[model samples]
Each structure stands twice: as C-alpha cells, then as structure tokens.
Target: MEAFADWLASSELGQYLLCREQAFFDRAVADAFGFRAVQLGLTEYDFLACNRIPWHGYAGPEASADVVCDAAFLPFDSRSLDLLVLPHALDFTSQPHQVLREAERVLMPEGRLVLTGFNPLSLWGSCRLLRGRRDAPWGGNFFAPTRIRDWMTLLQLEPTATAFMAYSPPFSRGDWLSRWQFMDNLGERGWSLLAGVYGIEAVKRQRGMRLIMPAWKPVKAGSGLAVAGGNERHPVKQSVQDEISHG
Candidate 1:
C-alpha cells in the first residue's frame, strides 16, 4: 500500500484525479444512493479511490455518507445500490471478479456500474509491463476492453459505453506542455493508444425483452398526420421529450 501511494504521488494521473470525471462520478454515486455508496480497493488511502469523497460529513436528511469504509469485501445487501464505480480498482485487485460479482449482487435491476483500468493494448500498458520498470505499479495483468466486455456479458451486464483516458502520463515535469499539446490535438478517443487508464460503463441487461406493436394502440382513422407504416400514433409522446430534457 505504501509503495502504491509513493508511486501515485509521483504519477501525473494522480494530479489529474481532482479534475477528472472519476472525481465527479464519485460524488454523483453518493448523491444517487444517499448513504449506500461504497468504495472498495486493495487498501485505504489510495488516492485514485479515496480522493473522490465529498467534503460534507455524510449525506441525506438525517443520514449521510459521502464515503465510508475500506473493506474489500463490501457489506451491502443485494440490490441495495443504484451505482457502483470500480475506480480503476480492477487493475490492482487480486480477486477482481469476486469484487465485481459482489457489486452485481448489490446493484438494483437498472443499476449502473463503471470500471476503470489500464488498457493492455495501449502503449502505456506495453511499456509498463515489458520495459520492466520498477518505479511504479505497472504490469501485472493489464486487461483489454473486450475481455472486460465479455465478462460483463457473462454477468448479464450490458456495456453501454467505453472511453479511455490519461493518454500517457506526464512522466517529466518539463514535458507537461508537450503532453497536453499531443492530447489536445488527438482528443481522448484517439489518445487511448497512449492513455494510462480507460473507463467502461455497464448496466445490468434486463432478461426479458419487450416487443413494441405499432398497431396495438388505437389511432383516429384517416388522421391528417401520416402513420407511415403502421397504425401507431405519429406524434410521439411529449413526455419522452420532457424525460429526455430531464435526463
């Protein structure tokens, strides 16, 4: 743990933790779940995992939990949470699947899970492992995004989105400008080739499927609006618009 902390203290991603979406999601999870948000990691004081806790002493009306506990085996009940964030915890966890299964067990039907990890296909992953660097926690089993997608499928979690980040650590203080220039030119999607980490968002895929019947609902015969192929109403519900607006 101490070694990990030392490495992080020197890594550029550590510095960016505050400005990144990781920080935002950490707080968002807490807000979405009230007192149910929890973080699991190899150990406490991991900046990547710990820095996301909110400033307030807890959350909710009478209860609050900006962040709580460091137990690797979480103590939450089944379907007890709305959001689960891995916080790049998979890269270092010895029992990654076990942790993920626990998370699945605790999440509700439509719950969302986000995972962040090092990308083995990326330049950073290759150099970190093959180069045999001793300074940082590089290279154990750097995983590709596809393998993670498979795992999510097996667990009935559908990957809704995938994105890469950290496109290459700013190893030297003097090279900061160059790194930013490169990233700015390439943008995040193209930058994944060099990114230090990548994040994937997955949601539990509902087992049963729904079939929409365009003709099921009755429509006024010969209405001015064209039904096109079916009898379904042409004017989509305004509530959908409102919902999209809210979402």
Candidate 2:
C-alpha cells in the first residue's frame, strides 16, 4: 500500500488531484498559527505550503517522510504538536480510531487538526466502487464526512471549519479536467456532499470546559414586597411592615 501511494503521486490524475487538494490545504491552514506543524501522510502534496510555522515535519511508512512511524503510534510527545494534517491517512490505515487517538494525544489544547479523506458519498466513491478496489488509490476505504466529524467530537475536538473539494470526476487530461472545473463552484454552492474530497479542521479543546454564566440562582419573588420591621408603615413600606409585623 505504501508503494502504491508513492507511485500514485507520479500519476497524471494523482497530480491533478494533489494540486486541488493541496490548494484546499493551503487555504485552510494558511491562517492557522502554530509553532509545530506535521503532515502525517501523502508527502507528495506538501500540506504545509501556506503555513509559516517554526518547525514542520512529515511522517509515514514511506522512506521520503521525515519520520517513518505508525499513525496509531506517533513519535511526538503528548500535547506537543500545534498543527497536524492527515491527508488520506485514516481510510488507508488499519485502525483509524486509534490513529485519531494518537493525533489527539500529541496535539496541544486548542491545537488544530486538518484531515482529508475521500468521501464515500461522492461520485469518485461510486466510481471506485464500480471499478473495484484493486488498483492504486481506489483500493483504500472511503469514510463518510459526518461519521468522521462525529469521531472528532468524541475526542473533545471542536470542528471549526470544513471544505469539500475536487468536485469533478477523476480525469487524467488537463484540458478535460479544466472543462469540468465548473463543478467546483457548483459543489461549493449546492452539491457539497458530491465533492470527491472533504477537508475538516478541528481544534483540540481541553476537557472540563465550563460555560461562564451569571453567578446567581433563579430568584423567586414574594407576593409583592419584602418584609421590614418596626413602625415603618408608609404606603410603599406597609407591605413590608405587614409581613415583618406578622412574623
């Protein structure tokens, strides 16, 4: 599978898809301020192109990666990473949930997580299905966007933004792809779920967050006025005096 991934990057169709996906990555993470940013997989795309982080790293089973490590067991320290990008890593891995757990562990509180994957509900997904999962990229699993978001929420990560891209069908020729580029606008406007890929950005929020509300309990009012004491029996004070005198 790793060999397939490396080879896919050299393919014409893969290049086109990479350019589109990388553009989305660039736009999504351009404003994400952080010191350490890591691209977990798909080294071909250079997911950190638009970021100005102090330190950046790449990790995968591929030798080209900065660190070849398991996605379910990253080498970084707990709460050390500021930004993490997983480009088509989850669906390709054996234990996707465990990989997410590792990502959450390494990310600091309020750190950003950018995940990209093939949407199972898209046209590309259907094509991959009809074509069978025997060849290079199509061989991997295609997870749904909503299910992916739910998984992030379970880890106490809040999704800040999501973008769907690569709306046109996977085409090899540059001219053919350009003609179908109008689909990108359409997908962004109305047919969002049909986009081939979805990029989701979530922040790793710490547990035990509390909402700040006014420090007061629900107040109950007496019949009209409060009770006062002694001979303070003015008209307005009579109600108070009555209650106090009765007591």
Candidate 3:
C-alpha cells in the first residue's frame, strides 16, 4: 500500500490516474445526501471533499486516518453510516469480499456506496499481466466491473450508476500519455467497458412490508334496526346511520 501511495505521488501515470479518479469521486459524492460518510482507504486523499454530509471521516490502517482499522472488519455499527467511499481499497485488500460485506453491514438501507477499482479486462490489465506481480499496482488484485456488480447484487447493494475512466494506456512518460489522450474520448463514447478504471454508485436495498388497510363492511340501513310498534327505534344505530348519511 505504501509503495502504491508513493507511486501515485510520484509517477506521471499514477498522478494521471489519481487526478482522473479524484474528479470521478468529486462528481460521484457531490450529490449524495447523508448525515455521516466515511472513506475506507486512500487516507492521503480527501475523496469526500465534495460531499455535503454533516460528518465525514477517513478509516484505514494508516496513522493519518481518523479511524485506523482494517477494511475487512470496520468498527462501525450495523446500519450506522449513510455513505461509504472505497477508492481502490478493494484492489489492495487481502480480503476484498469481506471488505465489501462489511461495507454492506455498516450502511443503512438506501445508503449510498461508491467505489473505484482497476478493471482487469482492459489495456491496463494486459500491461499488468506483462509486468508480472512484483510491481506496485500490478501486484494488486484487479477485479472486473461485471464481477463487482454481481458481488454487490448478492449483498443487496443495487448498482445505480457507473462511470469508466483513464482509457489511456499505462505510460510513465508524460508525452506518451498526452499522445494517448484521444483514446479517453473514444473509449468513453464507444468502448467504456474496456476503460482502465471504473467507479460504481450503489444503494443498499432491504425488503420491506407494504402497508395494507383492513377492509370494513358497510352497515345496511335496516339490518340492525328493530321494528318496535312500527317505529325502528335503535338510538345508537340511528346515530351511526345519520353520521354515515352525513358523511
């Protein structure tokens, strides 16, 4: 994680990816309404900066985090958080599935969950395969967006929106990256699923009972009345009938 952070802070390609991801997060989290929000990883960056939640904080293994804890076992109570952001936390975590389950447990029903991850079906994935498992980001697990959606569906986290970014190939040189900028637009317009990174916004859904009103039978006018001396004299029933007539 530290090596990946260092690369993000230093390498041109890493910086480019970071910038694009930040922009994605900014737009994704901006309209999410909530009382409490938390970012699970990438403690160095403020992924929730654009969020209007009353309380937002960072949680990670790093000392700089407001709540230092493992992503797989978050310390928050069940259904406590209104929003959660995972910025490549799943890729680096050893227990990515557990992390996602923990995310589901902590989020309230209808709470928003936003996550960014590397796509394993893209050019970037091909590069990582070529580079082997010794590099910083290449060593991390890259899950496909479809697989992630399937996982989220199992957890009842219905995907609401998604965006793909960083369509350019992973090039360390600034000039090379600039030359490939045209691919970004092309990929967004025609080949979005093959983008290097993907951001997903999902909402927690829980089964709820639909309210059903009890059926009431209407009283007939002469049913509960007694014919006493040719006069139907039931004061209470008469009052009820009067009320119903008026109504």
Candidate 4:
C-alpha cells in the first residue's frame, strides 16, 4: 500500500488530477459537464483524496465539502448527484462492488461516471513481473474493458465510451530514456501494444426506486399539524399504477 501510494503521489498522473492541467480524466470531465461540484474519496484515499484542487470556486479554499466519506458507503442522497469520478479506485479497493454500487446510487439518472485504471494485458503489467516482484500494486488486478463492462452491468450502468492512454509513461530515470525513446518511436507505432491505463465513461441507470408523490395527497399543515384522516388516505404509487395500467 505504501509503495503504491508513493508511486501514485509522485507520478505525472497524480499531478494532472491534483493540478488540473495534466490529468486527462479531470480535464475531460470538466469539459463534458462543467459540474458545480464533485465527490472525492477522501476517507479511503489516503493522501490523494485529501489534497485535491477544487474544480469549482464555490467550495472556497477551506470549504471542504461535496460530501466526504467512505467510497464503499458514500454519504449521499440517492440520485441527487450530477457526476461521480472514480480515479483508479478499483485498483486497490477490496470492496469494489460495494463502492461501485454506492456510486451508482448517488448519480442522477443519465449522469455520467468516469472511471480510470491500469491495463492488465499491457506492456506495463508485464514490466512489473520482470522486476522479480510477484505482488506489486502497479498492475494489481488491472482489468480489461470487457471485464469492467461486466461489473458495470451488475450496477446497471451503461458504457458510453472508452479510451486508452499513456502509451508510454513519461521518461523519468536517465537510464530509461533509451527504452522510452525506443518505445515511443518504434513500440507505440508498430508493436507497443501495452498502454499505461484505460478510461471509461458510463451513464447512470434509472432504477425503479424513484419515489412519486400523488397529486391528490393532502399537504399536512405546518408546525406539527396532525392529519385528520391520515390512516384512511392512501396515495397512488406510480410503480403500482404503471404495472396495473399497462395490463
């Protein structure tokens, strides 16, 4: 966990999300929705979640809001959010299913959820094994889009688009310059099949749980006013009505 956090903190990708200029997900999402706020995984995110650049100015420098809690159990009213951005959360999370379900619950119907993660079958995943490390987090369960689509299906989220990126990790060490150049020049164009990561965009599904208040329901008076015939009055439920009316 520590090694992964260190790499994540120092990596170019981290800088992009934190600073907004380098992170592809941040830039793409900001462009797509122009959201007024976003929910970040601060509780389980360790360092990356805590130190985030607010996309909107409404949450002032110390505002600290838009709901901060566990990703697996998000503290949000269902179907009230405009967008949910999952930044490589599945790579490390133990309860990915629960986390995804919570994300699906919060997102508004037709809202977009943008997810990013490393690719398992890419060159990057292979490189991790060559270093004599059997259990590193670099490619920890890096899933292909098809596998992810299965997970998304369980949550009822529909995939809208998918994109691959980071054909080459930005050359860092002086020694890796040759490999980077070779990969960029020849590998990417011809045989560089391993992309660093993949991103996915999915639309939130509208479950049948939407609550509908009937037009004829009597409005209770203010200040704890008791209804005279509350027990006798039955509101018409849309779901039941739809089922009965359809037949």
Number of the top TM-score candidate = 3
Which 10 consecutive positions of candidate 2 have the poorest summed lDDT?
226-235
Better of 3 and 4 by TM-score: 3
Please identify model 3 stretches exceeding 4 Å from their true place: 212-247
Of the two candidates 1 and 3, the one with more favorable TM-score, higher being better, is: 3
lDDT of 1 by residue, 143-244 (tens): 788888888888888888777666545454535634564663475546556666667878876688788867777645642433346555555455654665
Scored by lDDT, model 2 comes in at 0.84
Which lDDT values do the candidates have, in the order given? 0.58, 0.84, 0.91, 0.58
| Candidate 1 pairs with clashing backbones | 59-64, 59-65, 167-195
Per-residue lDDT for 214 in model 2? 83
Instruction: Give each model a TM-score.
Output: 0.63, 0.81, 0.86, 0.61
Please tell me which predicted candidate would have the highest lDDT against the true structure. Answer: 3
User: Cα deviation of 175 in candidate 4 (Å)?
Assistant: 5.7
Better of 1 and 2 by lDDT: 2
Tell how far residue 219 is off in model 2, in angstroms.
Answer: 17
